[model samples]
Target: MNSLVLVLVAIVFFIVAYSTYGSWLCKKWGIDPKRPTPAHTRTDGVDYVPAKAPVLLGHHFSSIAGAGPIVGPIAAAVFGWLPVMLWIIIGSIFFGGVHDMGALFASIRHDGKSIGEVIHVNMGDTGKKLFSWFAWLSLLLVIAAFTSICAATFVKVPSAATSSLLFILLAIIFGFLVYRRGAGLGISSVIGVALLFFCIWLGLEFPLHLSYNTWVVILLAYIAVASVTPVWILLQPRDYLNSFLLYAMLLGGVLGVLIKHPKIQLPAVTSFNLGNYKLLFPILFVTVACGAISGFHSLVGSGTTSKQLDNEKDVKVIGYGSMLIEGVLATLAIITAAYIGQDKLAELLKGSATNVFSNGLGEFMTGFGLPFATGKSFVALAISAFALTSLDTATRLGRFIFQEMFDKRKSADEVSSNPLTNKYVATIITVVLGGLLTFKGWRTIWPVFGSANQLLAALALLSLAVFLKRQGKEYRMASIPTVFMFLVTLFALVLLIIGKMSNFGKNWPIILIAVVLFVLAIILMITGVKALSDNKVSEDKNFKA
Candidate 1:
């Protein structure tokens, strides 16, 4: 089959779903344009400032896009393009879109509270505490794994290291100009983007040389500061700037596929085995978590985006629309991986999934008459940008969860109410823990992180279902997705525990953490199920009246 056909099909499916099912969801949930969003109702100016639709969408997309969509789809290509394509298309529509929209909607209705607090409103204080801890732990794993990945990329790719440093410097300057110096978004964005391209060129001309460990330390320190700062100053502007590069890369990939029209070299469906494990039923679900459906996205949705949402109607576009875009990216990733020959794909798979994407992207760019070196640098900058945006976002999210864990009132002021829960202190602690974990063993952390991420998604869905049920709104959309994610993620957790136990001597720490996650997931599931059942009974009684 031609890879272009797959791309076209995925694009059509996403567009139709966005227009039809996405609209249906909006109407079913009764989205009101006149409704005052949290950004308007609770304008803290720190976190809850009302952002323009385009800017908020850019921030939301960059935060969630990360490396997951690229990595997961490329890595899962061993199962063949057809299966991966189906999952990305179907999962984005029925699962990821609904989960993200529901999360954003729930948070806005609850004054920009995190999903854990949303859980609290529906399921009570105990459930809230448990969900908060679960979210925090999942974020810790994200910080650990993503920090190490970024560090390794810098060490391995000198040009990327140089470009990354320049990117951060440019973001700081851009933030100051826009937030303090009174520069317009139009002028600042143009200047920022122009400088970014120059950095890319400079990086190619004079690459940075740093040891892997040193890069890790630098990244951790950066996140510590970035996470605690006001969102507008760093997170929002940086994400908006980074998103342009991502959009260009996506567009370039699509054009390359169209021009080259490469044939799909990999099988349509292969055996279930992937390395030591099998890709049957639930394993594929776990492996392809980000591209199809991710729990981490719920964190991004409810964590920061909800607070910055300017309008209620924009939630569908930011939450559901961005997810569909990610699905498109995942489809392109699958096509990219498949286009590369089997031997090269296998070799690249031995390293980072980013390598496969970079190589495939380089090949695609060459078809457009660009030099391979230039193409490689573009890919590096794009991936580095993705990782960096996710790093600070996760750090900030971890801070939110930590602060909320202690403050029962769930007030926005609690973020700085005390030294212990102060934003700066919380961010430092989160980064320190994540950095230490990364230094100890990021490799061992990866497996558990993947499972924990999906498990969080399941928990977020359950929380959303409960929220919807209490409102007497249509909740089957959230409930069905919740059950599917819960079972798959739980299965993955058990397998991870069993695998860890088998290597107990060398992996005792990971084993313990895996068990903790498994137990926590079970407890949350129980709480969610009970809450759901109770809500159903109450709804029935109200209907009988």
Candidate 2:
């Protein structure tokens, strides 16, 4: 199969799905344009500030995109492109779209509370606490994994490190201009994006070199500050501006494929099993997370995006729309591996999936007259920037989850006598724990992270289903995905634990963590079942809101 034709077909299918199926979902759930969102209702200058549709989409998309789409698809390519492609398309439309959209909708209706709060409403305080602990732990894994990935990338391509830092300073200035000085979004965005490209060039000219360990510490420190600062100053503007890099990368990749028309060199089906440790069923679903559905997306939807949402009408575009866009990126990633063939991909995997993806994208850019070295560097910079975005965002979400464990009704900035409830204390504690795991490196954390991430999606879906049931809304869309993800994640976790047990002394910590996660999943399942069995519909006046 030709890469161009395959990509074009996927793009067309996504557009159709967005228009037809996505719209149908919007109608079924009743999106009210007139409804004032939590961003307006909460009106906190820090996290709850209302953002324009485009800007919010940028933050949401950048945070969720990270390296998952690139890394997961490329890593999972051993199963062959055909199965991976089918899952990306099918999963995004039905599974991921529904999961993301539902979480956003549920959070907005719950006064922009996290998913833990959603569970609190339908289930009880105990369920809320359990879910919050589970979520915070999962986020720690996210922070550690992305931090290691970004730091290593910085060591590999020092130019990306330079550009990434420049991107942050630019975001701060952009935020000040647009928010403080009351500049227009239109002109500011035009100038911001233009300057962003220039930064990429400057990065290439003057690369910043740092050791891997040094880079990890610096990245951790950066996220610590990024998580605590006001969103507009750093998180929002940086992610918003950085999203353009991703957009350009996507456009270049598509155009390159169109011009090059590379043949898919990998077989359509490799085997159901890759080795003694790998299998097709659960592993594929767990590995290809962000491109399809991720539990992490639910945290993002509820934690930050829900607070920044300007209107309920933008939900479909920012929520479901972003997932579809990522699906396209993931498709391109798998194509890169397929184009390289199995043996070459194996060699690339020995180094990193980011290498495989960037090189593939770099080669594609050559078809459009860009030098491979420059294009490769550009692609490298883009992924590293997004990885940094995810690192900080995960830290922020971790802070939110930890603080919410004590109190869900109030924002982190609100006054609380308990030291644990203080935002500063919460942020520090979260970062320290996540940072401790960072030294362990992403390679060790990634397997368990994948399983934990998918389990999170399952749990989030279950919570959404319970919320919908209480409101007497159509919920099979959420419930069906919940069941499927639960099966996939549970099986994957059990297998992972069993596999690790062979090296009991070396892998005991991982086994312990995985075992705890398994217990959490079982407990959440019981709680969700009880909630679903309840015949009493919630009469909360907010449901109508």
Candidate 3:
């Protein structure tokens, strides 16, 4: 099979799905453009400022796109391209798109509060508290793991470090120009993107070198400030400009595939077992993680994206559209592994999934007149940039969840004067804890991130379904996806617990955390189901699912 053909087919599938299925979802859920979004209703210039569709899309996409799609798909290629590709395509269109869009819609309807608050309204305070703890902890793992990952990347390729810093400064300038000085997004974006590429080039000329530990400290400090700062000044604009890097990389990868027309060299199906005790079913789904669906996307959607949404009409495009784009990126990622064949993939995996993707993508770009070394470096820098984006965004989200936990069902703008609810204090607390875990080693924290992350998706789906049911909206779309994710994550967590029990002494903390998450999921599931069962909605309209 030609890789280019696969790319073309996936693109068509996404476009059609977005136009038809995605649109149908919005209509069924009753998206009203006339209804003021939370951003407009609660404009604070901090987290609740209304954003143009393009800028919000960029921020939302950048926050969620991170290394997950690239790393997860490439790593899961162990199950072979057939299963990985199948899951990415099918899962994204139905599971991920609906989950992402639904979470965003649910949050906006609740005045842009998180899924936790949605749970509060529908399922009760107990479910809300549990979900908040679970979500905040999961995001802590995200901050820890991505912090370490980004730091290691900086230490390995100092040029990425230089460019990443330059990117931040560039975002600040762009934000000020567009927001403060009334510069138009069009002209500013053109200049901003031009400067973005310049940062990459300059990074190559003057690479910044720092120790791994030093880079870790610097990154922790960066996120501490970045997460607490207003959205427009840094987070939103940085993400907006950084999105162009991703767009460029995607364009390069797609054009390169077209020009090279590489054959899919890997076998369509490796054995289901892969010679490990891990079965193909749950492990494959878990390993693919964000490539197919992720719980973390719900956090990004409801946590940040919903707050900045300008209009209800943009929900489908920003929420569902971004997920489909991620699906395509995941498809392209798996294609990188497939094009390289199993032997090379195994070798590259020995280093990192990032290596496999960069090397493979670099080779692809050579067909388009790019030097392999430069192209490889460019790909590496782009990955690091995105990983950094996810890092700070996770930190900010952790802050939101933490503050919300103390707010007692209040909307985002109505936090009390409790010391714990202070944004700066919350951000510092989140970053400090994450930094401690980073020092402990991302390798230790990462083992359970997948299960915890997917579990989050299950919980978010549960919350969304319950919210929709309580509101007399069509929720069957969330039903199967909800049940499926719950099954997958629970299965994965159980397997993880049993496996970790072998090394009980060293792995007790992980076991304990997993057990807590497992119990939380069970409790939340029961609560959500009970809430739905108790609802008085007509059986004909809402009970069929």
Candidate 4:
């Protein structure tokens, strides 16, 4: 009915274009995303990347989607549907999608190490270390917030505990089948994915509860075990299984939307109240990445996903295309969100299902074939799935980064000098620290995920644009996007910082804390860039990610 709404529609169309157009460009350049892949490039187990586009896309999407899509919209909803929706469409096309695709292509082009490694080679180690530090901190916030989310849910729905165990055990068994046994990837993934559904069904049928403390411990234990295990055995299979779970949610969501056809009721513009906006520019960027742009996408791009490329040609599908799918999911969430009254939405979000997203999606799923009572629990489980998927992936990626930051320059052979150290110890260290924080409580840590996430997105995109600009021929296409992202994000972060400063004396501890973090983040980011610029490499020709 309004111009803004039309803008929203156009934005979505542009995102669809953003996802496909760049891929076409890459294809034109003769890039093959499916080449032997860096995972196979120098795999000794730890960095064993998958070469299949679909599989890696599954892994990347699951890891990146955690909490963002659900939480960001809810936060943005306060600002009204228009601003949030606009950002979602525009950010994804120019900011998130391009950043993700660029990072993926960058990593695949270089031998699949990480954004940190790439920066180190191009920018320098200090540059790498700075980004790495931010990355690890970002992940810690993620684990802490999500772990607390899971712990809190387990506290409420005790029966869900059994399902958690079921997932972990099932994932491990599935992992073994794929990694250790002679099981084919397709067949093993099929069985593994089926079991994931079975676990969810059982979780609903036989709910279990535990003390918040015990639940925290149990989840941490799972994280500890899950992180150290090789990707083939655990990460891959669980992620593979997670892929199915999410798709199921998508299927159920689409059908529910079609069948329910609920009416939209939220105001076109959320009241222009800047005070209640808990996060500032940078933090807002982080908080809203699920719907807009996300730094986590960059992490996944460089982490394990980059190594799996069978052909660089597929980068568009995996990186940009997968992000577009995530946007659609966020869109679906928003559509369902449009159904309930604001007061009712607020009430539902606060009660259970963790955040607005879980509650919204939970409600949406029930519209399909699920029972009402079970809907909330289903919502909780879905949130847990998202949290776990992010938690593990973030931890492993963080560890690799931490090690890379400190590890000395060495030949590729010497790089693996301590393979066990990277896979097991680093992962454990990351999980344990995060688990401890989660045990403390999510309410204490959750608010920060948005800020950290946005900060990383800002930095990563900048790095990507800079990297692209130096590519000469490629820079023509990338230049506009890169420069645009830099300006937009920089503006956003500046607004973010200003907002945070205003919140400095707020009564709300969380907002106050967020404000402080914003200051530090800005300083850290500046130093990181300068350090990178001063890297030993004068030409920026060599890169590691």
Each candidate structure's TM-score, on Cα atoms with residue i matched to residue i, is: 0.95, 0.98, 0.96, 0.85
Can you write out model 1's per-residue Cα lDDT over 1-545, one digit (the tens) per residue? 99889889989998999999999988877888887787877776678777778778888898898888887788778787778888899999999999888898888777788999788878888899888888898899889878887887777688988887887778878878877888888888788889888988888888989898998888998998888788887788888888888998998888888888888888888767665555556667777778988888888989899999888889889999999999988988888788776777899877687888887887888888988878877886788888889988999999989977766444434444456577777888889888878875445777788788889999999998888887778899999988888888888888777766767897776777778888888998998899999845332221211
Q: Model 3, poorest ten-residue lDDT window?
A: 536-545
Which segments of model 1 are wrong by more than 4 Å?
409-419, 440-443, 536-545
Where in model 3 is the C-alpha error above 4 Å? 408-417, 440-444, 537-545
lDDT of 4 by residue, 195-303 (tens): 7778878887887757878877777777777666667666766666777777777676665655565566777676554563443343344445567777788889888
Error of 3 at 139 (Å): 0.5
Model 2, 1-545: lDDT tens digits are 89987898889989999999899888878788888899998897999999999999999999999999898888888898988999999999999988999899999999998999999988888889899999999998999999999998999999999999999999999999998999999999999999999999999999999999999889878888888899989988999999999999999999999999899999998999987568998999899888798999999999999999998999999999999999999999999999989889999888799999999999999998999999999999999999999889999999888887876345546677778877889989998888888887887888899999999999999999999888888889888988999999999999899899989998887798899999999999999989988886886786672
Error (Å) of candidate 3 at residue 252 is 0.5
Better of 1 and 2 by lDDT: 2
Assess each prediction's global lDDT (C-alpha) against the native.
0.83, 0.91, 0.89, 0.65
- 1 or 4: which has the higher TM-score? 1
Model 2: worst 10 consecutive residues (lDDT sum): 407-416
